[model samples]
Target: MIQLYDSFHQASKDLYYSLTQAGFQGPVVVINDDGFLPEGVTSAYSYYCQMETGQGRSLYFNQLQVPPFWEITGTNGDGEVWDYSQRKAKIFYAEPKHLRRIKNVDWFGPNEKVRFTDHYNRFGWLFARTYFNAEQKVTSRIYFNQAKQEVLVENFMTGDIQLNWQGKVYFFDNRVELFRHYFAEMGWELSEIWYNSLSTPFFLSYNSPEAGQDILFWQEGIQEDIPGNMKVMLNSSHVRTQRVLVQQRQVYQKMMDILPEEQKAKIAYLGYIYPSLRENAGRKEILILTNSDQIEKLEELTQALPDFHFHIGALTEMSQRLMAFEAKSNITLYPNISQKQLQRLFQECDIYLDINHSGEVMDAVRKAFEQNMVILAFEQTIHNRDLIPAAHRFDASQPTDMVMALAGFAASYPQMVALQREETSNESVTGYQQLLGKEER
Candidate 1:
């Protein structure tokens, strides 16, 4: 077996270990750079013809760039004709932890966890390779097509059902009809589905609902408009003419307003989350969650809380604005941190400050809320007011009101703790139940 990769990244190293266990003893070939090569069996390949001209592996037939399926005809340093067609190999990219013994016939879980590096070009090539490698036990890519015997479940993204590693499959699905159709297409039975929050709207044009009975949808509150991504996903011709919109305030509430009363019975205000039990005791730190929409206010918030230490967690870095606030000594900026590192911040900080929210509650805010951190989301992001308790929210429209509110909360830090401790986890009240048949057994 032969392995190929580029760069010194975690993915490349993972591939090496996984490939070694899969009995690929051939020297690994790196495309260009050799700096991060494996000690014993790794070599770098650069194309240079004996003539003054240069050549690349992909550059075929008069230097026209073609797929890897095409071969490069040339003589190497050994002066032998290189016949690429003679080499027939299957490309495989198994996660390091998921590799089975070589030639062993055993089932493994899917690629639910993505552990690739920030090198998009390199990882993009890897994705392309592994996509075609779906046939030869590409756990994730192949499972979608070959999950007939495996049980599939639907829940929120984070609340994805757990699976037994050998064979059991627990899939997390967002859309009901779309998943049902996709499973049917794949020749798999749509066995079981479990939904948590009524986060996204189940769009419809009429008072009709989905026809699937082998499912459980725990309904939460509703809002007026559907998320952009959900709208695009539900744009199929079957759902297109049947879809409707609600002008109400909440997403699930809108669904409740339109749907028949009996249909609304499947939904209630109960949802469940495996809460983050990490404890953040007695830390006088504040966190600001920001993205492209909130950078201007992030700068202002840093100025507003000058005496306090602040950690700003941003997914993207708006260089100028970030740098300006980062100049402050009391402010510590964390950009593009891993989920694990971010979780550390969630468990360490005393308060979370979500100043500007577009609409949805971001994962950071949601997870932080679950951690029972003192969340102080601004009132302009009105949806946040619903997500967090009233005591933790300040009016974004009124700067003086926000300052005074923050000061009060800072003064009464112990009271904030007492409230979070007393209040039940937000998901418990969300209506979730097992779906039995018409017998109710």
Candidate 2:
């Protein structure tokens, strides 16, 4: 059995976790090698060259090797490299410094355009470099080995891949062919395949050796009609797909509404088994994680609901504007919050206020939802609308309504938690066992 995916993103991670929790023991293969995949996840690029598994080392800004006399400037989320009395040389983007591991570094040329980007593996090694043209378009990417030697080159201009494995040189017309070559080289039997994408993964499965039952775990949103590839998997006699598991309930409902009765049997709604970390003891505490001070109507909300204690935290130090909120009797500020403190805040706080204007800090909204916190957000400041329900969202001018709703939720905390649990729709192990046709041991 194998799990094939285009990338090891958050959705892919969730799906992989779900499958593993459901007693799946298979080699997970990712097509796109970002070089920063978490432990146990293998990429095609890494497998072809037989690269060593990542060591899970922490990549810090100071540890990065730079040119002589280059200066390193550290910020809240990322670091910058500047040439001696010259323009910006490179930008290092990564997690918070405390949990820092370099994801990638963008190199700038003399012309100030990004010439290439060095993608670093979590094992503290440079695994790939992506080159960009003058217009900032991707031209080619070169994958490297632990010896820093080029092992594979992918040309975006012509959609060709060149692999120099062992002593042989091979060329593929497209990524699918390259992936097929990889599967052949690995010599793994295509017994049972689980895929989470409809694009490349679908094609690879459809064109596979046809001995295995393909299960499509649909994780993407349905913007319009059912995807063409999914339709093929559901209706095509040539395809080996036996079932289509929709991860989102709304998307599953949409598929049910569109497909006929016969096709509906092949589809089912499945959700990840999210961890229960919520301890809503009716404390009436609200948590807000932000990197910036542009929290909309924060003062109004704090002033309106004096009974509800607001705990605002940032990974970095708060500015004077944000610090002014400390004067409020109901507000508590946490600057430079550690991982332990953050987890405690998530567990203690019953509500998460997504009214901060900025990029989300460390996927806080999702974490809040997983922690089973009641999420309330204003339309203008909401970062992720998918997790927060429609009834909980309010306009910027409707702070009074939001305050009232918070009060109502606080008054009926147990009922609010029940609703949240129902809305989560996390599937149990039995549902997954039934889907995979496995009997409980």
Candidate 3:
């Protein structure tokens, strides 16, 4: 009896049917965070990776629980090799405190609670390894086939699934799809997947009807415009396209308030002037603090902006570790910082550089503007208008071009900084209203 654990609804259903059809005489358990356990199952567990069991590993009403599980035998979504030993350690140490464990095997009960992570990666391999390491027992590997547009079918315990491309297999995490696509391009068949919260409906909030409808629009839009039969397994709950624009305005305005009375009244260029003074030519090291998702793209820009120093910051400890591994010699890489420290940094920078964005970028801009910093941005970028004030705009395509432009505004840096503060503090709710209008209409 092979135990196949999965979480996605439609894909899980497909795997269950496929496994049963393959003549596996065991139960397929579908565990989820919403306290959802399939009916007629023996018991529920928190996660598949932890070694908690029925007796000691109890949740609400005596349910058994396990730690989080992830598949680690293949390349990861970020196009990097996964550290399996570290991943196994993460599996063991990261488990919830309530569950107990012996050597392996986790257990839960009828009324016990379950746990789930926001993302699932490497779950298939993790479970397979867990069962294999424990009692030499194994189940199967199920996944999607990109080229054929089908799922790969195979049983891992007997190594039956090895290299044999059968029918289509479900991919629980789209990141896994990314991993598979990247590795498959290199002629490697990466097995295993971690299914996340796609089996059931998941949105940012239950109350926003407009947000829900807008997501539907992006989903359909992606399907129609984007080629290929690739399925969109998940999407953000709300449309965050204009948030950066609003923040840029707020930050620029706030900067003006913090300026000296005379500095505030300086009669200089009002909108998007390039720096000219030797002292104000962004000579000070400028850091663009940002999250993990933007790091890859930002790294490319840094290569072009050789005159400007660059730094990277990610929101998570995991990302920090990854950044440490990827950090360059001259570039500073810091772990996540508090909002207070971030605002202080903004004040210290001569030039506040921000990526044109839809969501969190606005928050960063608003913080910078409140500290009275001069901002630089691309003129024609899509979200540039929403995230960056027109007064600070610059040509973003080439860094050499921007440096030449900045040399002109160096002498007028004070004026630009003051303008930023004034723009950020203006209380007109026009931008917010515009954002609301999009979702509302």
Candidate 4:
């Protein structure tokens, strides 16, 4: 019998389907944390990277398909082998005819119930295996995704790796071309490069020196203009590391004014992303930076302002209900737009309505301000409120009030231009580079 343990769904499901379609027969054990997976899925997705060759003939691997680590030849009569077997990801044979049922057991041994708590962080799995030149056991920091019955296993751990690759010019280039260039320089044939949005990690392969670098992902405070994918960095097998970077920045100077002892290091005078501003080519465009959470607010605002062109830059997929608003000619909703496309929108729009969800100092709002677009925020934090002008700020708790204020502002076009003047500009994030490069005189 053959079995596969898949820890993630995105690309893995496609892999499974392709395998089954290709006539490969095997029982698959997958992460069932959600408890909603169809029959045939078992929750124990940990990589028992080692095999007990004395008792069993087959060696097992967890999620993503990998190059094999070990092999065995037919045992001799004297408990010795005359031949060697090739190691591979496929589990050619196994001890069990049927998929093993997980019985409320911990990886160490069996129990009456599942040992892992719902909120358990994954690095706690010491039983999980990491393979180096010789099999070396290392702990991983992976998140348990309950809904999809998924976790990233093996080389798919996502984290950020910053290699000073001949300075930062390579950072601005395309992924495929840059990788091709790297391989060309190294004189290696590039067989495959795989990365997906979900739990499956990315792999950059060549030889020992290029393989095990860590990839960093900024989780919490990301004040940069970047693509939807670049926001996260995951751990990969060829790549190394287990933690995600949660970068936080204090945007308002008033925070220091309130603090008796100002932590200069704590706050960012200018946030990430060098601003590229444009003079108001003002198209009477009103932009709203939003995500899935604020559907109702977005709908109401769009319906209320039928006369105005409302451009909703959806950072992520919102409900179909809000998506339905595109039926109205006045509302334009953009889902998962590219960084360049978003920048063009910023340059063209006249007013930026940042009725964003709570706990966000949205980089979009800042980017719009750098372009001298009128900034309006609702239910923003004190830190964000201080950054936005009083004339433009409104209480999101009262959606009607927010709409009315916007309506009033729209009626008074001259007032909008005056508010832009009242708001002061500081040295952009580009200038911060000089400050960072400066030496104490």
Index of the highest-TM-score prediction: 2
Q: Put down candidate 3 lDDT per residue, 249-308, tens digits, no spaces.
A: 333355345434433332111111122222333444565654444432355555555555
Residue range 1-441, candidate 1, lDDT tens digits: 223343434334533443343333544434323222334533211111011122212211223223555543321110111125342221221211011111111222244222211110111111111121233433222111112222222233233432223353334332333323333433432222221212221221111243322221222233464444334433533431222222112555666676565445543332223344565464668876665445435655666767768887655444665656678988887775445766678878877777645423244555665676777666675344444666666656566665565666656766775565444223321211121212211
Return the top candidate by lDDT: 2
Higher lDDT: candidate 1 or 2? 2
Superior by TM-score: candidate 3 or candidate 4: 4
lDDT of each: 0.40, 0.81, 0.35, 0.41
Model 1 TM? 0.40
Stretches of candidate 4 exceeding 4 Å from the true structure:
1-276, 315-318, 358-362, 380-383, 408-441
Clash count list over all predictions: 17, 0, 54, 15
- Badly placed stretches (over 4 Å) of model 3 are 1-283, 293-307, 317-330, 337-344, 356-362, 379-387, 398-401, 421-441
Better of 1 and 2 by TM-score: 2
lDDT of 4 by residue, 136-194 (tens): 22222223232322233323222321122323322213222333344455453233222
The reply for model 2, stretches above 4 Å from the true place, is 49-51, 54-56, 84-88, 96-100, 260-262
Candidate order by decreasing lDDT = 2, 4, 1, 3
Q: What lDDT would candidate 1 get against the real structure?
A: 0.40
Error of 3 at 324 (Å): 9.0
lDDT tens digits, residue span 186-224, model 2: 787786778988888888888876677888888888876
Error of 4 at 361 (Å): 9.6
Model 2 — which ten-residue stretch has the worst lDDT?
89-98
